[model samples]
Target: MSEHNEGDLFRQFVGDVKPLKQTVRGDKRPAAKDTPGLIERRRAAQELGNKEGNYLARQEHISPVKPWDLLSFKRDGVQHGVFRSLKQGKYVIDATIDLHGRTVQQARQEVFHFLRECVERDIRCATITHGKGQHRDPPALLKSCVNHWLQQMDEVLAFHSARPQQGGSGSTNVLLRKSQAQKDKNSEKFNRKTSRK
Candidate 1:
């Protein structure tokens, strides 16, 4: 309230306030043209072919199969083997077939046709839902048939009972080879040109 007291308060406020400085000092920085340490590490990896020698050595331990080793015909001399289940997830189809209405021979034909078409169309994986043997009076006909049919098909790369959510033991997930058309289309797309900016 008094002029002396107000002057003293103003002096205290001025003494507490600090002035700002805006200059920065540092070591000379590298330009954009300079390669980082990561680049040198990558260059060294490229020179070594990123462990290709180790991969080749492992491959050498395994026996190689030749073109002549493969059967000449699609169905000729093809061995039948059961593929219990599949591990990978991305390539899978969930499909169901009604064997109840059809006869044994008819059901077999339908399954064969479906599998053939899947292979021709390049369907990598599919689920064949032949319901559980719960309702069958005798042994489960469709289940047994599907098991045998899958083994006979040459195009079936691998197959296994689907997971519980996908029908479990009642359903099978089949993996088929890509058709020639699919391979050609993929190669063509891969060989596509990019425009220069």
Candidate 2:
């Protein structure tokens, strides 16, 4: 067949199909430029996040505890009665945080933030539910970390293993130190009573 006839046959087969426009494969629009304040704002945000996470230290050398072991701690000035009460789960738990599935780092950050918020809100009693890690190679790793972490916190007056119905050895009851406002209120009440005498 002649080349002209072949061209005619190709046009007939193609019909009215339009040719594609030659263009760049990707987006042609220029990248958006960040404002001067935007960069600074992002940096400040990142620094703030780091600062928040910095409240709790990621200790390298941690003492491991058994899965079934009971956790106990008390600050030097914490009364024996208060510690005992905490152990017995007599104080009402104002807040509770469960760290069952969280990583060590995640748990550390969460614990720090949660306790800080609790103290700010004048919460006296809080419970931390760190599951006894019987499945892990080093059993109760998070529990041991929680035990160590609680001791290092000044806000924690005392803590003990929770009662059986409250998660048994898998959870801990924490006694937080009274906020300054609460202490001041107590002092004011005492003074008022004494003055009335």
Best model number under lDDT: 2
Which residue pairs in model 1 clash with each other? 85-160, 93-127
Q: Write the per-residue lDDT of candidate 1 for residues 3-88, one digit (tens) a residue.
A: 99999999988987878997786685544452588456444544444443312122123232221121111233323322322533
Candidate 1's C-alpha runs over 4 A off are: 1-85, 88-90, 94-100, 135-137, 187-197
What are the Cα lDDT values of the candidates?
A: 0.56, 0.85
lDDT (C-alpha) at residue 73 in model 2: 86
Number of backbone-clashing residue pairs for each candidate, in the order shown: 2, 0
Q: What is the lDDT of residue 68 in candidate 1?
A: 16
Please give the range of 10 consecutive residues that has the lowest summed lDDT in model 2: 40-49
